[model samples]
Target: MIRMQRLIPTGDPARPVEFTEDAQPVPAPDEALIRVEAFAPNRGETFLLERPEPGLMPGKDVAGLVVQAAADGSGPRVGTRVVGHPPRGGWAEYAAVPTHSLAELPDSLSAVDAAALPLAGITALRLLRTAGSVTGRRMLVTGASGGVGHYVTELAAAAGAEVTVVTATPSRAERLRALGAATAVHAVAGARGPFDVVLESTGGADLPVALSKLAAGGTLIWFGQASRTPATLDFFDLLSGPEGAVIRHFHYAGPNAGPNAGPNAGPTYGRDLATLVRLVHNGRLHPEIGRTADWSKTAETLVDLRERRIRGKAVLTTGVVS
Candidate 1:
């Protein structure tokens, strides 16, 4: 029996995520077995690690080579390099990834870069698609320093939207501008808006303020509450805002639709990932990788990510130089 090194929850507050040896995983009929070379950390998964359930494996984004093809004859063939989202257990040497969640990687793309594109990339892609054509429109994005936030800013800007991002971090603001944000303000109030679209993630007190900045018929897509605070809005205040204004709930994996669905229901996880990868290959999209280290540093890396110390996406190589 072959064993692989994987990360698991220790269940101790002092150190939640730790490394362990586990038996190699077997692929499901519709899942391919990937020998992971690198993986990226998302903020949500790191939070779960702080008090994870026993036997819970935590990982969503990974890039590597296919070691075994799926029994059902789906996805990339063995020996193909790919990037994927395994529901869980991706922080291991091998993962059983569903075919629908995987995409082939080009030779020009490194495992580290590809690993950074799954969850965050897909979320940003879908959000922008939901907002429709941003060409010449005013848009505002909160939490611009985060993985998903930066992607939204860049993609919207590329499509010709005038993007204004809110971030208290002065240093990160400059980086956001280079990614195509027309302006970066220290607070939501600093923004000059009535924006046609708003991709808000920082929530809390900023949620309602963001809503207030929307144009008459604008859409406000609420995706996350990184502030970890509740947003309280008065009924009258909401009613007083722009007419036909909407606040749609969004998630990377979900129904991706509401009362008024867009022409596209939304792109699939695998489909969006492929688009992101192609954009990256063509230099049309850049994955803002803020940190890269060996997989052994996952615990420390995750801690930095949880505390919001790390910017953009964090990638960890599995001791594979090539």
Candidate 2:
């Protein structure tokens, strides 16, 4: 049996998880069996546990060593180190993941860092790509201290954009500045911009404020609703005459077309993952891992993430070979 951290919903909203052991997974023809070493906890997973299923694994990002290659001769070979976004979920000692979702890891990256990369990294990368050329452009990234926000800030900066960040945590300003943000502010009202592009993640009153800052012909990409609050906007102000800016919403699972494909489709996942890993290896990008604990602390880790006690990314490690 594999000792996996299954999400056992307690039916109590306050405390909702219990870990249990389970049988080891076997890979299918198009799947790879990975001995998972580390995984990251995301706030999105909290909503998934609300219904309380019995034996559901609650992680999407995983990093580990491949113990069994796919039966159909796809993906990485056995004994390769990899990071993946498993479809059925991945908080376990072993996961049977689709070959298409896997990316080989470089020797320089740690399991914790790789585990933190898949969802947040890819989201940030793809959203910025959608904005076209960012070199010398003015960009505003809302929620710039959060998981995806930070990556967007760093990557945009690396692309030569003059990045301005809006974050609730002012204490993270200096760190964000070091990552290439020209300025970091606590509120959107404090930001200075006629920004060429706005990556808006905080959806609430902030959404309208973000919309107001976009320069003529600028594009605003809305990818998340962290506040779980609604925003009211006047149609006239949003699309005013010929100077009205553009607003595009982004989700990882959208349909594939041209270079803009869904996260799992075509060569998007593997290609993007490879580029991200290379950037990290070359010191061009950094994955901020805020907290890491043994997998035994999975429940507490989730609580910390939900309460906003942890900054950046929170990771859980198995700490032993399977």
Question: Relative to the true structure, how large is the alpha-carbon lDDT of every model?
Answer: 0.87, 0.82
Residue pairs with backbone overlap in model 2? none
Q: lDDT tens string, model 2, 1-322?
A: 5455454556555665776656787678999999889999787886666665765667788999999999999899999999898876588778888887889988898888898998888888888777889999999998877788878889989889999998777678888998999989899988888899999887989999988888988888888887778877788877762266888888765654214465455534666777778889899989988899998888777777876777789999988543
What local lDDT does model 2 show for residue 112? 87
Cα shift from native, residue 157, model 2 (Å): 0.4
- Candidate maximizing lDDT: 1
Work out the TM-score per prediction: 0.95, 0.92
**Candidate 1 lDDT over residue span 1-322, tens digit each:** 8898988887664566788889999888999999999999899887787778777898899999998999999788999999998888999999989988899999999999999999888888878877888999999999889889888888899999999999878889999999999999999988898899998898799999999999999999999999989898888999999899998988766655322244554333677778889999999889989999998888888888888889899999998644
